[model samples]
Target: MSAPKIKCPTCTRVIEYSDQYPHRPFCSERCKLIDLGEWASEKHKIEGNSIYDDLLSDDLEQPD
Candidate 1:
């Protein structure tokens, strides 16, 4: 009998199922935690210019 192999999402490393991988998708626990922390801190954000920034002009002056 043989186990299946999987790829690590962080480094794209080929890992064997029998390696007792605690982190399934990642090759190591460190990589897994790094990815987890990224999500926790809201680091994964949508790429694009902010609409609010465009709507608000810095050059606009208020009447005294």
Candidate 2:
């Protein structure tokens, strides 16, 4: 059987999904780093409410 094909998340390049690809979803280290940079800079975020908001509200409601 042949390796499954997938597009690189960063560059949109078609790549074979196999053990040879250290960066599975990305084509290269550069592309992987770019994605990481985006996340570090808050360019990526999970949708929906976070528990941190409730925690902060509770903290604010209490005396400091």
Candidate 3:
């Protein structure tokens, strides 16, 4: 059987989902970094509240 094929999340380029591609979901390091940059810049986010939200808020509300 042949390795499965997938699209790179950043550029939508078709690639093989195999060990040959170190960046499995991405076509290359550049694409991987681009995705990471988007996340770091808050351009991409997972919907819904984070588990640490309440804990962080409580800590912030406390007197320093």
| TM-score for each predicted model, relative to the true structure | 0.54, 0.80, 0.77
**What lDDT is obtained when candidate 3 is compared to the true structure?**
0.91
- Candidate 2 residue spans exceeding 4 A from truth: 57-64
- Which one wins on TM-score? 2
lDDT of 1 by residue, 1-64 (tens): 7778888877889887775887786889988988888888988777886888766867657568
Task: Quote the lDDT for 63 in model 1.
Answer: 61
The Cα local distance difference test for each model comes to 0.80, 0.91, 0.91
In Å, residue 25's CA in model 3 sits off its true spot by 1.0
Give the clashing pairs for model 3: none
lDDT (tens digit, per residue) of candidate 2 on 3-61 = 99999999999999998888988989999999999999999999977888877775566
Question: Considering only N, C-alpha and C atoms within 3 Å, which residue pairs clash in candidate 2?
Answer: none
